[model samples]
Target: MVDFFTPDQIAMLSASTVRCDFLVKFEFASSTMRAWNGNTELVVAGDTYLPMFGFGQIDGLGMSGGTVSENVTLSLSGLPGQALDLLSVALDDTPEVDQQMLTIFLQLFTDEWQPAGTPIPIFRGFMQPPSVSRSAMQGTEGATQSISLTAENIFYSRSRPAYGRNTDRDQQARSPGDKFFGFVASLISKTITYPDY
Candidate 1:
């Protein structure tokens, strides 16, 4: 009998590391989206913050069974809408912003870690700040809003993760590592509530 347990356990252990990397990537992408979306409030030093009144994290899981897949839908009715045509997320510099994004990603990874244990490092990957486009919207009441655009078939995937060794591992572990990745990815589905500034 091929121990599905053994491979699954090792995969979970190795995935702990990979999970951290995945979360980091998701966080970076989220921050870039918010910054480039142009709805964030710019602070005194030009740093932007998610608008306080409308900011919230959308937490959920996505799953695929064979060719069919499902993800939780989030409501973005509380967030401010976009204005800029194409926001540039400067990735050429390694500054506090980049470090903050990394730290945030790690925190998010741990927070979403399922079948929770000590957080472990599992994989490594990076993405270029993607090419951006924008879409404009108009309300019947004469309001204007914009959205950062996405194209069809723009698929991207990171290296698969292998998790850390599970010591005193429970045979009935109810959670899977893929859920962590799905949750992080769902952050990209942010919507705008107030579009016109």
Candidate 2:
């Protein structure tokens, strides 16, 4: 295996007191949204990462034998709007999860909370329909809402993700100008020649 972490990032990780954050990105219906575990806003790669105190933490993020586990579970509990809009979409499209993708990025930070380097994409997977739990306001505690879900890893047990199509339309959906699949439509109808040896 090759070392992919930068020296600065390595140094940050090896520091006596280290600060780090996990940046989470959710892509659905061709839209991208970002959030981070830190308590403050951050700008990385020209994209703003808002604090996701609601994203309390993630479980089962480690890798073994160079392969990710089949599934990881995470929960997000927050009152801030928009960061949790993915929840609404999940509820509305309960049966259409193949079109959505969830990615986790690792970003190392200095003692001052400044980013050490660009966030590195560490995990890619699909988030299952989450179970939402809401609490009614009573006494001093404010109303609370939280979502919990299992994320199936894209690289599980040496298998590819099941959400894929080889059609031209699928290619166009991801990249309109990409014509690699332009000939796929014709190949199926074209005759093939075989040499006799």
Candidate 3:
């Protein structure tokens, strides 16, 4: 029962001339990844504020005609060394527990400068491990690096609900059990016997 969009915001978004700005925030818990510090400002390599190039729509794909998977990809340009290092940690296969993952929140604003009202929380999830890449050209243009990170929401891990009967248990039998594996086993045992037509 959470309200993601308000009436006024929805109306403004439907307008063709509405202007929106992007704000990115990174949340991490590690001494090496102390650059962001829960700040709303988008800072890279400790000194630069790189702007986002664009973002992919939050796509949902139906799995098995029941469960739906959702994810979004965000692209950033001119990422600094610090940001790259942070991404590297996430991409590592055997990183420390504290540096294993990081949560990234993206917000959209209707105004470009101050006096801007509270932005809308368009996306909030953990950044998928990504491999960083850089490109350089010999022309007059300098070198630039772009980073893209995809995040999966809660629905990405959800599956279709199981249909079955529940077993009654007393307080003495209410012990902890493997809910996930147990549920899967139960579903597999309930084989439907269709009429022999």
Assess candidate 3 and give its TM-score to the true structure: 0.45
Clashing pairs in 2: 54-77
Model 1 residue-pair collision total: 14
| lDDT at residue 18 of model 3 (Cα atoms) | 72
Task: Give all TM-scores, in the order shown.
Answer: 0.22, 0.66, 0.45
Off-target runs (Cα >4 Å) in candidate 2 are 66-69, 78-84, 95-99, 135-143, 156-197
- Per-residue C-alpha lDDT of model 1 across residues 124-175, encoded as one tens digit per residue: 2232333222334455544322222111111223222343312112212334
Q: Rate the local accuracy (lDDT) of all candidates.
A: 0.29, 0.71, 0.44
Per-residue alpha-carbon lDDT of candidate 2 for residues 81-112, written as tens digits (9 for 90 to 100): 55546567656766544436788998887667
Candidate 2 RMSD computed on C-alpha atoms after optimal superposition onto the true structure:
13.2
Clashes of each: 14, 1, 0
Q: Report lDDT (Cα) of residue 32, candidate 1.
A: 48
Q: What is the C-alpha lDDT profile of model 3 across 21-66, one tens digit per residue?
A: 5444444444223222222445432433333223222233223322
